[model samples]
Structure formats: C-alpha cells, structure tokens
Target chain A: MSYCVNCGVELEQSLGQCPLCNTPVINPREAVCNKSPFPEEKGQVEVVKRKDMSILLTTVMVSTSIVCGLLNVLVYSSRPWSLAVIGACILLWVILIPIAIYTRLSVYTSVLLDGLGTVIYLYMLTFLSESSQWFWGIGMPIAVLVTLVTEFLVVCFQMLPRSFLTNTLYSFTSLAALNIGMEILIDRYLQGTVQLGWSTIVLTVCIIVNITIITLLSRKRLRNAVRKRLHF
Target chain B: MAKREKPIPRKDWYQLDLSAIVYPTLHRHDFAPVYRQSVLLTEVVDPELLQRAVDLTMPRFPTYKVAMRKGLFWRYLEPNDRPGPFVQPDIKNPCQPMYFKGNNRYLIRFYYYRNRISLEAHHSLGDGTGCMCVLQTVTAVYLRLKGYPVETAFSKEQGYFVMNIDKQPDPEELEDAYMKYANAKFCPPRPGEKTYRIRGTKESFYTLNIIDGIMSTSAVLAVAKGYHATITEYLNAVLLYALLKKQESDRRLRLKPVKVAMPVNLRRFFPSKTLRNFITMIYPGVDPRLGEYTFEEIVTQVHNDMRYHINEKFLRGDITTNAATKRHPLIRIVTLFIKDFVIKLFYTRVQDHNSSAGLTNMGALKVPESMKPYIVRFDIYMGQPFSSRTNCAIISYEDTLTINFASSIIEADVERYFFRKLVQDGIHVKIESNREMTLEV
Candidate 1:
C-alpha cells in the first residue's frame, strides 16, 4: 500500500494520491518512493467501547459469599447453636432482600438492610435475657471501631502510592488523628474536664513520624522527577 | 545634504582577551569575542570596482552612513587617527590589521582578506535585515570592480545614526523624589566602563555549528503572502518550533514560555538613527502548552508580538524618557547610566526565562548575487554569547536557508534534539563540524 508523502496515510486503490491527507502517493514497490514505516492515519474509524467488562464480575462475587458462609457454619462451628444460627441467618437474609431491592439509594438501601438484620438479631437477644448494659458500651464501641477500620483502610488503599509500609504509616497516622479528635469530644461531653493521657501522646508521635516519612519519600520522588518536570 | 554630524565616541560594553581560549570554528557554543573564526571567499576585484558595489548596496541601505549619537545611551562613533576594526596592524595580532584597538582593549576584527569584500556584521551591530543592505551595497562595489554587470545604483539609505547634536534625556519623574534624592546606595557602571578581565580567560568558548542558506526572494515573499508578515516571521517560526520540541519533555514546568528575542529597528520606531544599539530587543513569548502549532500560527504570533513592542505607545518617549536636570550633568549622567545599564540586565533575564534560545531574523540580504562569483553561503553570529545561555540564528541567502544553533548550555541534548527535530521537519540542516567545517585558522 502506498502513502501520502507530506502527511503519511495509506492511499486508496491505484490512485496517484492519498484521499485522506491529499498528498501525492508513491507506491512502495517503486525504486524512487520514500516512505516511513508507520503512516499517520488521520480521521480513520476505530472501535471505542463504552463498557468492557460486565458478566464476569457477577458470578465471582456470588460464589465467594456462599462458600465463606457455608464453610463457617458447617465445618468450622465448635458450639451447639448451629441450627439456631443458620435459621436466624436465613430469616435475616429473607427480611433484608426486599429492602435492598426497593430502596432508591445504594448506600441507604444497604444501610437499611443491615438495620433490618440488626433488629432481628436484637429481638433474638431479648429472648436470651442477657445483661443490656454491656451491649450499650462494649459492643457498640467495638462495632464502631471495626467499621471505621474497614473504611479507613479502603481509602488509604486507594489514595497512597503502592508501597506497603507507606500505606500502613498513612493509615496509622490517619486513624490516630481521627481518634485524638474523638477523645477530645468524649472528654468534653462525658467528664467535663480537659485531660491528656499516654495513648494520646503515642498517637501524636505516630502522626509526626508518618508525616516525616511521607515528606522524605515525596522529596525523593520530586528530585528524581525534576528533569521531567522543570522546564528551566 | 543632511545636517553635518560629528564622530561621537562609542563606548565598549564588554572586554575580551583571546589568548586564554580559542575554538576553531564559528560553530562552537562558547562566547569568543576576541578570536572569532571567519571564512573569506575573496573575489580578487580592484578597489575602484568594489567601490561601485558599495554604491549599489547603499541605496538599499543608505541608513548606515549616519553618525549615531544616542542621547540616552551616549554611545557614538568618534573621529580618530585610525580606522575602526578595519585597520590592519603589523606583527603580533594578524587580525589587528583588520581590527582597530586603541586605549581601550576593545578591538574589532573585520574581513577583507583578499581585495574587496563585504563584512558580515555581527548581531551586536544590528539584526540581519539591518546589516543586509550594508553588505549588499559593499558586495555591489566588489562586483563592479571585478567588471561584473553589477548595478551602479547609488543607495539613498540614510544609515541609522544620530549626528553632532546636543541631545539630552528628559527629566525623570520618580515619586520618592526627595526621600532618596540626597542618598542612593548603589553606583551604576560608568559609560565606556569595561568589565574586569575574565580573570585569565574568564570564559571558555566553543562553537558547535555555523551555517548559511539562501532562499528565492519569491519563496520568502510566499511565506508572507496572505498574512502580510515579513520573511523574518517565517524563519523565526522554524527556530521557535525547534526549541519548543526540545523543551516539551520537561514535566516540572507547569508550562514553558517560548520566546523569540527580536531586535526592532528604532529608526522606524523613532525618527532617530544616529545611535549605536538603536535597536531594542523585544521578546515575543508563547506558552508551548497551547500545543500543535502550525508554522503559519507561530508566524502570526511573532508578527503581532513584535508589532506591539514597536508600536507608538512605547516609542512616544514615555517609558524611556528621563527628567534629569541639564545643569547637573552628574545627575543626568548617573540617571542615564542607571536607565541604560541597569534595565538591560533585567531585560536579558526576562528574555532568558521566556525563551529557549533566541532567533534573530535580520530579513533578506540584498547583495547583487553576481559579486561573490556564485555566492557559496551567508552567515551571521551575535559576535558573543550570553554569560551562560545559548542562542540560534537563521540566515537565508538564495535558495538555501541556513539555521545556526549556538549554546553555552550544559544540556547538549537541547541543541541535539532541536537539530534532529528540525531536520525531521523537512529543513535541510547542515551542522558545521570540527573537521568538516572549513573556517579561517
């Protein structure tokens, strides 16, 4: 195939010139013809898919959840409350499905589904007649801690550059800062006093150390990237 | 006849000692003010015939004969018992015959190696366009000497020179007036002051390439056909594109400003021409981040950017005017010294930040082609380089366009990439190599 000399693009048929770039074309087979390896194709049509992957995701997610649940209940259970637990789990799932499907917001609907399951389990707890005070303080704090850990970890994973120690330091500093603010609020509302403690000091130290490491790493990155970045 | 003029004393801005360092070719990137390499294609013509060529080239460049006397800069050529730069001396400095050096270590090296020829003026004198007329006239004189059918045109050009007139700067209107009136800290460089000896060759010099090309007068006109831009704009675009490609890879700079420092003819800007350095450097800068520029686009930008600076606003003696009292010659002199010397450094820095290098289009050289016996090439250098920066020049002779890239640059790749990209863009670029380039030893 021949191409345009001025703006390289393939010529059509045995035509003397390229239709696209509109320059005179010389056949590659000819002795005098000069051509570059890759022709600059202007305005040629090509495939552009809006979405690339869809079906593969659904099967993997459904299978993983089912397998994890079954293994935990059947093979790993050491206590005798298996039947009660399995029945409660099925009941919770049946109640949550309708809320998940009907709600307009993905976030709100997921929250509502979790709420329904929590309510079901709480009703079952009432039947057990355990002390309610423990639930208010211990269970609630542990639950909040777990959720915060999960969300913070996910964000740190997405934001920080792909370095294991860097991401760990980033998360540690972020969590420490978060808890310090929480501590101040808690002390103000509950104790009605300003107080400093060992944990607070430790958290502050972690914040500083993490920040220093990140700053050093950032500087190194900049130094290496200077020629690429600085025009002068 | 125009008013009779006096030969005012011209001041030297910098001094050079050539013994410390020498680069063989005009292509070296170093600043070599003392020993510049030149090639003389002597067309053994009689002095009388060469005189005729001077007549023809001058109607095109009659402006050069005027004696320049700058009111602001105070740089004018004064009468002496010697020829300037063209004087030949015996013994030690072979070029001293062609050079004129007196009390000041400042010497000029001119070429008339053979009989009659034209001296290619360095950028320090004027841009290519300004010098072309002078050169062409000189070439005509040489052709006439050689019995070539050269035109005997008496050029009516009144060279850009100011004569023996009492010209003084306007008084300055500084707001801090009396606050610092009795006391200002720094002393400016005195006129005709020379810098300290580059402490034993204070500078290292080298030239990587020196080249010349010629374009058909019609082809140059074709570049300006629709836009009405000058051929300088066209050649400037080619250099600008080469530079933009060189620096485009730098990621640190948010955006690089590509500037072409073009010297505008002050004769047209102002009615004055008798002053040396009458040409003011104007920078036409563009942000390369704009992307995918066509040669035509750069040409248009260069056209507007240059036109703006040479416009009436800057020329009306507004920014350049001073109000120093005539009675206090000291105050006036000091004020003028500060204005001329201090501001130039600032302008140079601004230009560096805004440009990769410089591209000076002197316009077309109009020498009758017959004089040089099939003119081989035409080239121009700035006579010196910036302290650390580099610059490029493009001179078109007839059918060929010669692009010269000079540097004192640390990064060799800037020139390398620029030339590579330029050749790729369809300009037939020939670099002056050490062995390949034939220069005066």
Candidate 2:
C-alpha cells in the first residue's frame, strides 16, 4: 500500500495514480524487498473461470448407466430386464443430459429437463411391470417429487445471498413455500395415497425451525455487518 | 409632420425575456430586488414641514411629479393591451406591475388603502432608491392630510440618492394609445407634483407560515450580541452551521456569495429628480464559506464585512450594465436581439442557488404614537423561494419579517424547515398564507 505524495491518501490499485488524490504510484525497489514475503494478493481484478466440465459430463452418465445395465444382466439372466434397463439409461441420457448442461441457461430449462426425465422413467416402469403395486401407486409420485425437489434446491442455493445466515434463511423460506404449494397440487391433481408422508412432515419441521432462528438473527443492528458491499 | 406607419423599435429583448425563461416560482427567488421595508410616518405631517422639503427638492428636480390626469399629457401605465410582437398579453392584468422599455416609456405604481401603502416600479426606469423616495414623499403627504406636525427640516439624507439627467422622455409609442389631434406627440410626461401616479397593492408572493413563539428583534440581537455578532451575522452564521450538519464532506463548503440587488437612487449622485426613470442596481453577495469557524468568529466576519460594503461597494457603478455610453443605435439593435433571450435566462439561473433567497431591511417605519397609536405592521414584497427548484424572499418590517418561498408542486417540509431553523435561532415568527394577498402596487 503506497501513500499519495500530495494528499497522503492510501493507494489501492497499482496502475499508478491514486483515486482519491490522483497521485502517481511508484514501486520503490528497496521498499518492496523490505515488505513481507507472502501476503494475501491485493489489487487483483476479478475474472470468471470457465471449468472444462462438459467433456466429462456425457462420459460419466454413459459409464454409470453401463455399470447398472451389466449388474442387471448378472442379477436376472433369463429375463429381458437387463436390455430394458440399458435402453432406459440410453434414453435418459439422450433426453436429459443436454437439458442439464445448457450454459447461460435459465430456470425453465432445468424444470423442463426434470419433467422429461420423470415421464420417461415412469413410462418404462409402467410398461415393464404389471403387478408391482408399490411402483404404480406410490413410486411414480415420489420419483417426480424427488427430481423436482433436488433441482429446485440446487437453484435456490445458487441464487441465495452470499452471507451464510441470509442464504440459509432464504433457502428454507423458499423450500417451505414450494413444498406447501406442491403438497396442495399433489393432493388435488393426483389420486390414491396422495397424502404427504412422515418424511415430508420431518423436512417441513426442520425448515420452519431453521428459518425462525435465521429470522431472529437478521435484526437491524446486526445487518450493518452485511452492508460492507455497498461502498461502491 | 403627420407621419404614419412608424416601426416599434426592437430593444432590450433579452432582459425582458428573462421573465419568460425562468418561471416566477423558480428563478424569481434568486436575486433580492432592493427592498427598503419602511413604515409610513403617518401621524404627523405638518404642511409647512413638507412644503419646506418640496421647496428644497424642486431646484434640483425642476419637474418633481408628472401629471397624467392633472396635466392630461401622459397616461399609459393606467392600462396597455395592444398586441405587439414582444409585449405579452399582460396576464395578471390590470398591469399594476410597472411596464417600461426605457426612460419616459414606463410605469410607476402606488397601491393604497386606508393608511397602508406600497410602491412597485419597473427597473428599466429607475432603481430602488428612486422608488423609496417616491414612497417617502407619498407617506409625508398622507400624514399631513390626516393632521400631524411633521417639521420640514431639509436634510441631505432625504434627497441624497436622486439622479440627475438631461435627456427628454421618449415619445409616445402608438398613435392609437393617444390620438395626436395635431401635437406631433408629447414626450411621456415626467412625474411632477400635480399629477401623482398610483397602482394596486404589491402582495408578498407566498404567505409565510410563521410560528410566532414570542421572540423579538431584541431577543435575537441579545443572542447574537452574546456571540459578539449582530442580528444578521448571528443568523447567517447559525444557518451556515446547520447546513454543515446535513452534508458528509469534510472539506469546507463554499456557497457563492448570496447576492442582494441594491437599487441606488441616482438623485443624490447627479442632483436631479425629473421623475423620468433614473435608477441603477448593485449586487451585494455575502460569502458563507469560512470553513468550521466558531459561531462568534463567523458572526464577526459577517458584521464587519457587510457594514463596510453597504456604503462603498454599493453603487460603485459596476453592478448593472451602463446603458449610457452604449446607447448607440447599433448596440441597441444587437442588445435588442440578445437581451430578448439572454437577460431573462441570466436572471433565471443566477437568481436561484447563486444568490439563494434575499433578506431586505426596509428600515424602521416612523409614526407618531398619539394619532395612529403606533406603526402597526408592514410586509415587504419580493419573489418567493421555490422548493427543490427556486429561491425565496425575506423582507423584514422591523421586529417582524416575512419568509416567502414558493414551489410549483408545493411540499410542506420546505416551509417547515425554514420556520424550524428560524425558531431554533430564537426568532419570533408568524405565517400568513394565501389568506391575505396584496391587491396590487
């Protein structure tokens, strides 16, 4: 940190002139050597880092499906279940993978992908098994709910405030609202064992308690600590 | 010499256009037109005393008051509504506001009712000092009629400010305003004693919402005196301090000097009172940027600084542009075009934040206690301050003063703030809103 020659104000960025005093910055060679050897990097401009995660996306899904298919073949040798499972995996990849990875993609794309996956999985189950009562009555709703819940939680977590407490409160509040609405929709729109079970009750209880604690913590005076970002 | 089809010469168009560019609520508030808020010494005006004053004044003036009815030679200010290209269809009519293109072609208005009187004049003709003289003369005459012994001791103070000039008043503008039954057309008659001109009331722009809590001029003076400051200095210093509390900048704030336009009566300067428009203006600006000084220190500066300028700096002949030497035909043509747009624009912006609002001391009004008890109350008329937009006018009638601020879209807080600050400074104030408007003057 160099001080301005004219006004003695601190200089932030090293491109030379100070913002407050408009004084040029100079790196005196001897002064630089006298400073600490390692310090937190200062005056760095932020840039977005693009992760090369796409190339590995399809490969991982295909390999996971193949392993499950091979396992199915070994478990049931005389049945066509193994072939069916493999077909299901290939269809899921074809329909869902692209939807999952659309960069600069919006929330609607994510929801659409979850919808497609639910339809395909449920269709396969219905066609493949006639006597499986659990899959027909309870299993289909659970599958769709799980997929939607996971996607929504992911989206909420990403969009929440950077502070830990605010983020937690936001996630809980959003999830609670989403779940209650979804429960109403499920009961009215779907039939048979439509009521929410014990797991749903447990999740709701946890969210409510956590949200209360967060709300209490978010009082006025304490919020001052969260205002450091507004200087600009 | 029965000529027809005369051209109405285009002139001073810019200064005239200033009213158009800056609306009354916004721009008019910036500059303080010279205000000498005085009281009519109405109780005692002995004729012998006034006659003595007139005798002394006449040798210098030659033609004291011009007659319109008494002389039947000059009469246009009563009302004019001809559709000239520049003359606006005089809105807020009966055109009580003086209308003057230059010398001779102008109006002098005096509004009166019972014992109260107000004098409003157009600037192109003369300055405030001249108007004040006219007001003083009118007051003296009224007191005599009401039966009072006002000694006519001739003091230079009374006639010390009138202006002397040799140029004749301009010829009548239109053949239609007055049909020349064969006189070529008389010069607009100068105000002589026989034919006195009159106008309606000059109302205070806005009704000041004064919360009168029993503070007086003496109370404020005492507080300021405690700080080794006079009334104005103490008020100005305290005002500056309050302004400092609202902002975050550590750097000292510097407001452009608050400018008050002082109209110098030219009668004393040259030695003539022909009543043919001879007045000039002076802009007195007070600097408020002394940066974190103690209240006492700031007050001392304001007191000493203002007292000095009130005499020497005022009427130094540099305030208003001198139209004498530059009254060439070519210059008038250029000025006519330029001033048509420029002067009005200049008044609009300059009058606001640069000068802010005005504080005019019309001085103590004198009257005998027996006949009329005492001078009851008086209000000084000026442009009002605009909120978030314009300026205000402050006129002091001795112990009481009116703060008039205006807004196109009025808000309650701005007025509240003005009074709040005044009360905080230990000033006794009262407010009168649109309840009592001045008729016209």
True lDDT of residue B283, candidate 1: 64
Cα lDDT tens digits, model 1, B1-441, are 134344333323221111000111121222223222222344443544444444333322322322222345243332232322242211111111112122221222234434324343322233344344345545544544555675533323533111111122111110112121212233322112111111012222232222223235455456456456776765566566655655555444555566666655544644432322344456665566777677668878877876765674553332133212222466446644564554455434442344445566544444443443535555554433444444566555456555444443333334444444444444443333111111211
Chain B TM-scores, listed for every candidate in order, come to: 0.57, 0.50
Once superposed on the true structure, which residue ranges of model 1 sit more than 4 Å away at CA? A1-232, B1-77, B83-107, B112-134, B144-203, B206-208, B211-230, B250-254, B268-275, B289-300, B303-354, B368-377, B397-400, B409-441
What Cα-based lDDT does every candidate model obtain? 0.42, 0.40
| Residue range B1-441, candidate 2, lDDT tens digits | 123334334221212111111221122322222122223333433444444433333222211222111112111222222221111111111112221332233233433333345444443223334445445554544444455543323343343222211112223211111111112222222111111001112233322221111135566677777778655556555434333332213233333333333333343444443243443333333344434455455566656755654452343333222332233365445533354355455444443334333333333333223323434454444333232322233334456544443322222333344345555555554333322122221
Q: How far is candidate 1 from the true structure (C-alpha RMSD, Å)?
A: 27.6
DockQ values of all predictions: 0.01, 0.01
| Structural similarity to truth (TM-score) of each candidate | 0.42, 0.37
**Cα shift from native, residue B48, model 1 (Å):** 13
The true-versus-predicted C-alpha distance at residue B380 of model 2, in Å, is: 1.1
Docking class of 1: incorrect
